[model samples]
Target: MIAVMLEILGSALLGLGLAAAAAVLLAHRLPARRLVLLAGGIGALLGAYVTHEALGPGHVLVTLLGSLGVSAVVVSLLLRPAAQAAAPAPAHRAVP
Candidate 1:
């Protein structure tokens, strides 16, 4: 059980790192959400392939879905603050 948990955790972190790096590289060319989604999707497919090769064919779908979810969450957590910081401040209105 502990080994399984560790594997999942490791997979998630690996997916998160890969997605985050891709998103960063694509940040200037795409919207934050779109970049994140694209990166996460790519990470999912890659993770699935790796897991299938490493752990056999039975685990591909599960690892793909898990990596997708983990990547999305990590990307959002990473980019949200940066988005908020980059947003323009609201303009002040003149008093009536």
Candidate 2:
């Protein structure tokens, strides 16, 4: 049981990392939030499917929700700073 829990944790981390990478790459072409959402959704679906295949459908919903949360956090952490840095500073207005 412990080993199986560790395996699930590892799988979740792997899914998070991959989704983060994909969201970062997609950030070049799409808005960061959109990319993150897209990646998270995809990761969740994939994770759920894989977990279902390996562990049975009983685990699918939990894995799907967990992966979605993990992927969103990973993407936000990886891309939010980059997006902020890339954005232009607001122009200062002179007092009349």
Candidate 3:
């Protein structure tokens, strides 16, 4: 049903969003942008899968795998690159 599909997709998107936020929080201490990006992607994937499984009517394995894959791809492509690019700005000092 369309409703079911919508629910699943919506949940997945929400999860992905949350994961990106979490990753940003974790990124603060991390030195490697790649690692942060990767971590964010993983977090997003987990979020998407959990969201989908909680709302969708599917087998546990299917739900987990499907959501994980979907979330991973979406978050990795959409969020990871962008997040990784953001670096702390250097403090400006007065010119001698």
Candidate 4:
């Protein structure tokens, strides 16, 4: 009961922290800040809930770790690839 609640709270905090770090470190690669934060927080919460249900109580550390992993994956999916410059078209040669 209480343990479960604590796990949820902890997982959510961890998720938010991870999102903030990602946003700061990879601002160019990530989407909007709000979206990243939302995805990370929700993903972690969902992960924690699922893990807790599957593993049951007495496994708080494992559950939190699982939640963090899930949150990271969710945030990573939102990342955009680095932009590349377009190549110029080759000049055509005139035939004699």
The top-ranked prediction according to lDDT is 4
Provide the TM-score for each candidate, comma-separated.
0.39, 0.38, 0.33, 0.89
Task: Write down the RMSD of all candidates, one decimal each.
Answer: 9.8, 9.5, 11.0, 1.6
lDDT head-to-head 1 vs 3, winner: 1
Model 1: per-residue lDDT, tens digit, 26-84? 56544565556565655554555555456754464566566666565545554533333
Question: In model 2, what lDDT does residue 11 have?
Answer: 55
**For candidate 3, which ten residues in a row score worst on lDDT?**
74-83
Question: On a 0 to 1 TM-score scale, where does candidate 3 land against the true structure?
Answer: 0.33
lDDT of each: 0.58, 0.57, 0.53, 0.95
Writing each residue's lDDT as its tens digit, candidate 4 over 1-96 gives: 899889999999999999999999999999899999999999999889888989999999999999999999999999999999998999999999
Candidate 1 TM-score, C-alpha based: 0.39
Task: Give the clashing pairs for model 1.
Answer: none
TM-score of 4: 0.89
lDDT at 3 for candidate 2?
Answer: 45
Candidate number achieving the greatest TM-score relative to the actual structure? 4
lDDT tens per residue, model 2, 54-95 = 665446456555665655554555443434446788899999
Query: Compared with the true structure, what per-residue lDDT tens digits does model 3 show for residues 29-56?
Result: 4445555455445654565556555766
